[model samples]
Target: MSRDVVPTYVGTSFHVCSDRAADISRSGSRTSSLISSPSSVRTVTRRQSTSANTLLTLDPRRSRSPSRTESGDLIVRQPAKRVPLVRRTQHEAGPATPQSSAMSDAAKIQLVCTLGPASLDPDVIRKLDARGVDLFRLNLSHTGLEELAATVEFFRRHSEAPLSLDTEGAQVRCGSVVPDLVLAQGAEVELTADEVQGSADRLSLRPRSTFQALRPRSRVGIDFHGVLLRVIETGPASARAVVDRGGRIGSNKAVTIDPSPILPALTDKDVAAIAIGRRMGIDHYALSFATSGRAVRRIRELIPPGAHLISKIESRAGVQNMDGIIEASDAVLLDRGDLSREVPLEEVPYYQKAIARRANRLRKPLYVATNLLESMVLNSRPTVAEVNDVANTLLDGAHGLVLAAETAIGVDPVGAVDMVKRAIEAFERIPVGLDFTAPGAETDGALLTLR
Candidate 1:
């Protein structure tokens, strides 16, 4: 016999047993019913106020009671109480100074931190939330749906902070390296499309297209800018190169080939992540390696309504297509780490200002991510330079700051968040006159003119 499937709100279907029906009897003008199913047997009390269409299910065995009605039917009743949804607010500590008081009511900067082993503890997450982390980012690049679901559920149970599902969009990286090979300067190496044991001489480059698109004289960066390889020859399935710079390269580290438009904007893993995000009720999604307005629209189709889409600008193509991407996306993220590989190191600041300017002009939220506090990954405090970078990013009209490794694997996740909050507090101390001509000014000049 075919089983009747019952759809649930939790994105899963369960079979319902319909073979047995409830037997109703009247005892002293009171109606009692014995509801029997394959799962459990329960007694339901009939009330004049109870709707006829109401469906009843037996409570779990642990919660079941031996109470019965006059007709000897087990007594069951619908729950009379429910847990109310209460919104939790973060409390800022310390004595409120003139600067802190002025900035307290001012527009607050949103802080987004990536989740990992370092910040997985519920108590740690609670501390981070209380310290003012507005959202938690789940990087899908490192974990799959099963693991992601559990993590999301845990956060939902423990805190009120929303989740941002970050997709590993079309970003290519080295798959595996054997023995953690180290390359010396002027040494020849091969980047092959096939999965093989990587040595100092050859490494595995997945997606295959990255290898096929290579040309002689092209540069390849390995291990997050650790080493550089200059392509000397290209073939159908591999490219031969010489180590321009030497360093220790490990397995699963990111690899960057210069001029990265050859990579796709969306990958199969990204598609699966979107479906899971929708079911999990993710508040926002950060699309990595975004390059064009068309790519943003395609991802929008997959995402459900009410969820914000953030386009990560991390490549030369993404920078060139900034206007279109900003227009299409709810927000734009400046991924400085990967973007530095596409453009000159010195030009990253210029690109950041340019992108921030355009995004602000369009009234779109701009997020500055990556290396905001590199020192804090190991240190308990941020260096002056790192703090200055965060302050300058805020001055550039960024609406948010994204902490990746600093909070994901850092030694002090709470300290990193506290530092970011202090940086924003410090930036707001500079009092400036409002300009109405500013496209995305927080307030109109007329409002301040009366003062």
Candidate 2:
């Protein structure tokens, strides 16, 4: 039998279903009887009012049923079973585009833009929104409570994109160092626990616990390993180090130490920020440096009930505990920046693909963040390599791509957003299969042949 297709609205979009046999069996030939008899048939079709994602079923008996008009032609009206369409924000992205309609929930690429001085303006936010920004991230590490509240209020007034408050999990960073101190090779410097205006010879670091963990001959990296320093001596609240690799160091840059110290998952500032965020009705929270399932559950408890918890995997512990963390959280985020501190730079890509595949298997959303368009931080266009990387990330099972400095502090914030949108579209255009299996895939010989 030729299948009868019924076109109906699942949400705002129309979905076609083919299940005429079930409808016929349920209606007991009443439809056939009416269709066979034209005299009793009437063209009575009323479209259910759909206002702003309202879910309403189309009933053929009352409105949309096949009938015969005066022209002696059969008119077929589609009737669909009731299916509730739950509304989701862009952050919880679903396959909405026609090209992506058949894609599963994991295939929808969410565009997450971090709000910063460059893109925090109302106009820029609106532009990013128009380009389809799914979520706006507020880095708690860089924001105080008052400023965080104000920023949250400001975005609420401007855009409807969901806000994500990213906690500053256990990490060390350089305190106020003015004039961009350029440390030369073999230059001796002092890293103090005391807060001070830093200079070439002396600097301060935060989370004194990490300073206390330092030992003689320990290797330290500053500003994403821009400059390398080795500890020459340790003190009660400080450490003296000699520069091994020279580079310009700036204020608020990340600092990494060998034998990373054990710190609390949530900082005092993070708790304060969460309290402020809860008051503001923010429902999305990203826990930075999420090391284990226990930590994810802990943060999940602190947030509002039913709020989306995104665990950021950036440390060695995080990678080791990936399965448990992915199982515990609503979603997972692969932070390649801080992750490199523990993981070698060359191995980052391998980790990214592995994390993406794991997240896909566990049916959780995974967002890749950091340096997506690094060159665009100063330049108007992204590097070719960066574009390729974005596309490959999607192919590797990343449900979303996050623009940090690219949209937050880049020279052309809107342009960066546009590029991300373009990258997603380009990825969708490719017909590459992400889940491919070789014949007898379990065997090493088959796997090698496929490779």
Regions of model 1 farther than 4 Å from truth:
1-105, 144-146, 176-181, 194-198, 232-237, 259-261, 430-451
lDDT by residue for model 1 over 232-261, one digit each (tens)? 999888889999999988876677877553
Q: Report the error of model 2 at residue 162, Å.
A: 0.7
lDDT of 1 at 321: 71
The TM-score, computed over Cα atoms with residue i paired to residue i, of candidate 2 is 0.73
Q: Candidate 2: misplaced stretches above 4 Å?
A: 1-87, 90-107, 432-451
Candidate 1: lDDT of 252? 64
**Candidate 2 lDDT tens digits, 269-346:** 899899988887788899998888889888877888878888999987787778888889878899999888776576
C-alpha TM-scores of all predictions? 0.69, 0.73
Candidate 1 local lDDT, residue 247: 91
Error of 1 at 133 (Å): 1.2
